[model samples]
Target: MVSPERHAALQQAWARLLDGYRVTAAAAYPVFDLLASAYSAPDRHYHNLEHLAEMFRVAARLTAITDDPAPVQLAIWFHDAVYDPRAADNEERSAELAATLLGPLGVPRDALDRVGRLIRATAHLTDDRPPPDRDTMILLDADLAILGAAPERYARYAGAIRAEYAWVPEAEYRAGRAAVLKRFLARPRLFWTDLAHQEGDVPARANLTAELAGLRGGEPAA
Candidate 1:
C-alpha cells in the first residue's frame, strides 16, 4: 500500500506538472478523476490504484534524471487505463482514450499522439521497434520496477497478479505467466533508464529468475 505521505507527494507532483504546463487546476482534477475511473476494476489486483501510485512515484524519480516529463506523466495515467484480463488490446484501447483525453486538454496534438504511442508500447507481447522516445522508456521502466523490489514485495506482487487472473485455470495461468517471466529474463536490460539500469536491473533479473524457478517446482536460484 502507498503511504499517505507518498500519496500526498504524488498529488504534489501532479500539481507541479500542471502548474508548469499552465494547465488549469480545474482541468487537471477532472483528468485525474477520469483516469481513476478508467482504471477502476474490481477484478484487477496489481493493475489497480496501488500500481498507478507506484508508477507515479517511479516516474517522478525518473523525471528528475530526464529532460521532459509531460509525456511520461501522461503515459503513466493511460498505460493501464483499459486493463482487461481476457483482452489482448488493452494497450491500444488505453492509448486511444489517452489521445482523446489529452487532445482536449490544450496539449499539442503531436504530444497527445506521442502519449498514445507510449501507452501502446506497454503491451506485454510486442515485436515492434524499441520505444520511440525517452518518456516511453521511462514509463515502461517505472511499470516494471516492481520486478526489482525486495523478495517479499515481489512475492506479494506475483500473488496480486495471479489474483487478477483468477478466472483462468491454474495450469493455463502458469504457462502464460511463465512465458511472460521468460521474456523479461531474456532481455539484456530490464530497465531502460541509466539510473534504473544501475539501481534496479540486476535485482529485478535475480528476483524474476528465482521466482520463476520456484514456480517451476525447483529450488530458487541463489
Candidate 2:
C-alpha cells in the first residue's frame, strides 16, 4: 500500500491528466473514485493503485521513446481495471470498461483504440498482436517491471500473485504458474524497450528462473 501522502499525489496526478483532456473536475472526480474503488477491492492482493503507481514511474522513464505517451498513460490507468484472478479475458473486459468510461470523458475514438490495444497487449501473447507500436512496447515493459525487482520484492510479488489465486489448489496453481513463467523464459527477450531491457532483462530472467524453482518446491535456480 502507498503512504497517505503518495496516495494524495496520485490523486492529483489523475486530476491533472483528466484536466488535460478537458474533463471538468466534477466529471473527473467521479471516475477517479470509481477507478479507486475497483482497484482497492478486497479481493486484490496485487494489481491495485500501488501497481498503477509503479507503472506510472516506468511510463515516466519511457515517455521520451514513445511517439505518443497519453494513450500509454491511459492504458496504465485502465489495463488491470477489471482484473479477475480466475478470468481468461481480464484484458478484454478491462479494455471494454475503459471504452465505456473514457468515451464520454473526452478521449477520442482513435486514442481510445490505441489505448485499448495497449491494455490488451498486457496479456503478453504475441499472436494476434497489435500493429508494431512503440507505445505498446513501452506499456508492456512497464507492466513486467516487477519481474526484475530485487529478490525480496520479487518474492513478495510471487506470494501476492499466489494470494490473488488463493482459491486454486497448490498443485494446480503451481503447474499453471510454472507454464506462464516458462513461456516468458523461453522467449529471446523479456523486455522490448531499450531502457527496460538494460534495467530489467538479466534480473527478470534470474528472478523468473528462481520463482520457477520455488514453484516446484525447490531452491531458486543459481
lDDT of 1 by residue, 1-222 (tens): 556685566566666666666778778777777766655567767887789888887887888766878888878878898888889899999988877776677778787877888888888444234666678778888988999999898988988888888888776777778888898888777877888889998889988888788767733222
Q: What's the TM-score of each model vs. the native?
A: 0.86, 0.94
* Each prediction's RMSD to truth: 3.1, 2.4
Clashing pairs in 1: none
The runs of at least 3 residues in candidate 1 whose Cα sits more than 4 Å from the true structure, single-residue gaps closed, are: 1-12, 124-130, 218-222
> Which residue ranges in model 2 land beyond 4 Å of their true spot?
127-131, 218-222
Best candidate, TM-score-wise?
Answer: 2
How many steric clashes does model 2 contain? 0
Per-residue lDDT over 1-222 for candidate 2, one digit per residue giving the tens place of the 0 to 100 score: 778887788788888888878888888888888888888898887888889999999889988986668888889989999999878999999999999998998878998898898899888878234338788888888898999989988888888888898899877888889999998888887888888989998999999998998878744322
- How many clashes does each candidate structure show, in the order listed? 0, 0
